[model samples]
Target: MDRGEQQLIDLVNAWAKYSEATPDADVAGFCLHYLTETAQPAVLNQHSPVASPDGLYDEKWVESLTGTANRSLTEIRPSSRLAALVGRLSKYGYFYSKKAMFPLNFKSIEEPVYLIVLAQMGTPKKSELIYEMMVEFASGIDVVNRLVGMGYIEEFPDENDRRSKRLRITEAGLTILQECFPVMNRVADVAYSSLTEGEKALLIQILDKLDRYHAEHYKLSKNAGFDEVYDRMVT
Candidate 1:
């Protein structure tokens, strides 16, 4: 067949795959559904059973494929759609943020501790940053060691918790921040440059709400619908 016919067949095959049906087994069903919903009146009025132009296929062959696509979509659409959209949002954020960091020449995951140390400015113990950065205790220790070795930060025994250590960005770290922070700020500006100030505030507010909800409830909510999960979390 020509391009149009081949493309139509390919499109139906794709929908079958998306819906998690075997294309060779279920294609006729997908095609039948597509034609029923979208075909012209003349096509629908045809006397003979519908088939590929090669006459190797027929509408009856697709009879059981009916609603397979809808059933698949119904089962997965809610979670899948949210995952796809939110995943892209996170992916692009990381993409731009990485591009922002390229000039810093410190691409290791541990490098962010320098910025965190500067931002927190000795208000928090180095141990506490493990939770703040959502990393393991050992990981936080490793990063802190790396920063200390780099002379970008200095750690001191916490007065209240003698076993714990608080961190402060050294003058050297501040010097590096002078070079790096502007690049981060510029990248952030480009990333959110589409939003108005009000929209930015609103987005932050909404994200805070989502972050809190998910942080508290995501483990409990897995494989469960939102209302059921929320109810479980509340009770």
Candidate 2:
């Protein structure tokens, strides 16, 4: 890995240790330090976190620091800084999710498949649900196929388009998620407890910004049918 990526991985490992030691500290601060430190300025001043009066960080600033464009931070790129951070968090999330849902093993069901199924059951609209998950965690068709093979989910013909399909989590999948709900909640609590209230809010704000930005840009790319945009970006 490059220095920046290595630093991020190291910071995440440190945060994991810190969470175990001081589960009520400011986790957001720690994560922000990781991102901002590797950022272009070499040393991030207070102004770095605060979006400009126009409500966005300078494009050149991001590019110079991260060796990528500001647009990369949005949906255009799969491996943006925020995307990498979220990917790491999702791996952590999947680990916890699996731990929570253990003992009811679906040998063929991968982490991404489980996550997608969980999303479908939680949200009403399949498209919206998939979009939300994509924003929070990216996955591909191969993962979905595995879920189908495992009988955890089924794809039905969309009423509007026979060629397209909609996903539904099977009863078995729902049962697993229901059993795991409490444990998953605890996992979230454990993860978030590492941050103070202020730090939690700040981290939420930063993530929300990245999520929204990506959603918008993702839509644009989809409209243009730009499939290859994410080909080189996944971790």
Candidate 3:
């Protein structure tokens, strides 16, 4: 057979095997499977916990999470499990980033982040900056006050509205923020060290989808109660 015919036969055989393994997967998913197996053979599949590309999770440990026993994962839905992982990862990232920021005279990551945002905003109203961060008014005020006290940022009266105040990063803030970029990069490096390039790309696609969803909902849910938000967004 010619090379083109041979390749076509191989694709058919691969599709047959892939359909057998993943009965629910669509043609698009099979195309990805075929490409992953043939074109990008070095990049391992992420389905099996045993075959985790990072090799951080132990197969035996993963298999043990079942039944009505203590610490069992039997009742946890995939969404709940994923949420828990996201929470834990956020906490871990906070820990590393906290340590990373401490040397720059920042008590928390918020200080430098506020300066960075203000710098990007080129003098935003205090409320505008706060809302951009999605923080409570009091908490945002506290950070602003601390930054003002530290000489990292300054507040000025708005030209149009004398009663309104605008915020911007100062020279000192710029110096410190320049120093923080590399440290924060290291923190990110540690967080993403386990994932391969393909995995990272795929994860970014999934996370960006989630972030866009939440960004819209956060605005609507700001004044809403838990049940009110849940009923509207979830059930």
TM-score leader? 3
TM-score, structure 3 vs. true: 0.69
| Stretches of candidate 2 exceeding 4 Å from the true structure | 1-90, 95-98, 106-139, 157-165, 223-235
Q: Considering lDDT, where higher is better, how would the candidates rank from best to worst?
A: 3, 1, 2
- Give the runs in model 1 whose Cα sits over 4 Å from its true position: 1-80, 108-114, 121-123, 160-162, 194-202, 212-235
- What's the ranking of the predictions by TM-score, best on top? 3, 1, 2
lDDT of 3 by residue, 13-34 (tens): 8888888889697887887666
What are the lDDT figures for the candidates, one per model?
0.63, 0.57, 0.77
Residue runs of model 3 more than 4 Å from their true location after superposition: 1-74
Candidate 2's residue-wise lDDT over 1-235, tens digit each? Answer: 7999997897778777666766575866566655654444323333333323343445534553454543323322323454555666766766765665466553322544455455656433346445544533245455556666767667777777767777777776566556656666676876677889987887787788877877766765654534565552333
Q: How much lDDT does candidate 1 score?
A: 0.63
How far out, in Å, is residue 154 in model 1? 1.0
lDDT string for model 1 (1-235, tens) is: 8999998897866686646744455545565556645566545445533333343233322332332222222223344435555676666667877777766766542475456555675657875666667666887677778777878878888889898878788888878877776777776787788999867876686678779987876556645897897687656
- Reference-based lDDT, residue 51, model 3: 33
